[model samples]
Target: FGKNFLITTHYASLPWLDSLLQEAQEKSAEEHLMSRGIAFLLYTFLDTLVDSYFPVLDDIDEIIDDLEDVTVNSTSNDVQVRIFRIKRSLAQMRRVISPQVEVVNALVARTGKFIPAKMNPYFADVHDHLIRAFEVLDSYRDLMGGMLDVYLTTVSNRLNAVMKQLTIIATVFMPITFITGVFGQNFGHLPQVEHDNGYLFWIVLAFMGLITALQLWYFKKRGWL
Candidate 1:
């Protein structure tokens, strides 16, 4: 029976179980050596995997901080380009981080086979860390949303300021245009049409009317009329 079981197990690649069995066989006086060896092997494997995963989570946190800085302090077209790059980086990070969460969850929900009963609490702790990482990611997403809103509002305010300046300029020049147009007419029976002083008189009157209209408009716009 032992020979047949060994033959059947040899057909599959269970390196972890093989290592445990080999170790138990090497120790001649061990009681329940196979089970003890397997338990130790599983604990060490989980420990190594969890240790490796933590560095990856730290890298993700660093990326989030860099993205937040770029999004919040950017003031040029370069900022838009940088924001797109950061978004892509975050997407890639999410892809990796989500699977890690699943892996931790699976470890926590293990039956009696892969993980020993004593190791369940350690895996549960890892699951808690993964949950915290997901929460941090959610908060970073919210901050990015707020930064985008502020950027749009800043652009809108600048546009409104430009429009207001143009409107004020147009208002200031409107009376000058009207005065010039009225004096340009070639009517034969006009009041100032027959004297040398007529041209001078019309020019002075037009200039005076333009100045008065401009002053009134300036006063109105400045709230001092």
Candidate 2:
């Protein structure tokens, strides 16, 4: 069974290696180089891989900066939504980056004939960078998470403040509403309905009540009540 599996794997690997060999041969033929020039060929392959990943790293860095901007400047719900979208994009970027880290690690782990010994350190450096990138991403994720929490708390606090202001306004108007409602009643038996000083008395009482409430509110605001 192992033999059969090995045979199948060998066959599968042949097409891929054949393609690599064909490309190497074409490039070598263009430069009129021999198969013994494996180091140059390996260098070309590794360089191409490194170059491809550099752009990915640059993109991730750009995304991190954008996310940082969103986290900093976000105020309204719309901005929060944008921040969340940035986070989603960062998450997707990490998904792509995480596998690339493995690819680098795999390259570093291999003692393959294709990989030159001197190039291993360079690959290891790249792998280290991948690790650092992941760490930075995690830190940024935590920062953004904290930022989101702060934003939510700020919004809630603002809402609470608004509610308190509205409540205080309602409380301030309660006595005025009560006085108006009582005076507006068309009851014929009311004593104030027939007295000349009755309107003035009610007006003075309403003013006094309003003044008392205002003084109380002012004292409360200043923490001096």
Candidate 3:
């Protein structure tokens, strides 16, 4: 078997692939990999690539769990950013895994010059691994979507609660504001303003307090509180 094989990527680095290949090269002599021929080496390389996805999927699963809890319990922008980032990661994983599954399925179905009959089962195993990984990725995509929906619902509910409180406060203060404006007018000889011994001040205060209490009671009766 050759000591070197080409691994290409557009903008991503496969450091784990490099490490696995180097390890395989070191053990090639002991495993008699040369005698088994390059086909076995190729199988090993593909198997390593397929197996690498599991650990990454596991990490993503843990992240999804954490995000699920945070999304439900918290209303922070950071949670939203993390959810979108995880969603993007899942999309990228799907893009990479989907084509790989098709390619591996083709390899298993066709025994061409490059793939001998004896190696067909080995390639088929790789195909199975790819299919499993693809399924897991799709599940993660669904979970991420659910997480996003939950986050949005939680945020919306929180906003509605705040708005409800503000509306109640404004509603309760509306009559008091009107009473204040009516009594503050610059008219001469107003009915309440002409009272002796400042009784008008106490009367207006009592009247405003009574109206506020009535409004609060109505709100509570309607379950708006």
lDDT tens per residue, model 2, 100-181: 7887788778755556567677678777766777776777677667768877777787778788778767766677777777
Clashes of each: 0, 0, 0
lDDT tens per residue, model 3, 1-225: 234443446567687777875775777566754456566667777788899999999999999888788898999999999988998998998898889888877777876555667988998999999988988988888888888888899999999999999999998889899999998999987885776679878888999999999989998999988
- Candidates 1 and 2 compared: the better one by lDDT is 2
Q: What is the C-alpha lDDT of each candidate?
A: 0.62, 0.64, 0.83
Q: What is the full ranking by TM-score, best candidate first?
A: 3, 2, 1
Evaluate candidate 2 by giving its C-alpha RMSD to the native, one decimal. 7.2
Question: Candidate 3: where are CA atoms >4 Å away?
Answer: 1-13, 28-30
RMSD of each: 8.5, 7.2, 2.8
Most accurate candidate by TM-score:
3
* Cα-lDDT of candidate 3: 0.83
**Model 2 — which ten-residue stretch has the worst lDDT?**
1-10
RMSD of 1: 8.5
Name the candidate that leads on lDDT: 3
TM-score of each prediction: 0.62, 0.65, 0.88
lDDT, candidate 1, 70-168, per-residue tens? 655555666666556655665675676688778867767775644567777877776676676666656656655666666666667767878877876
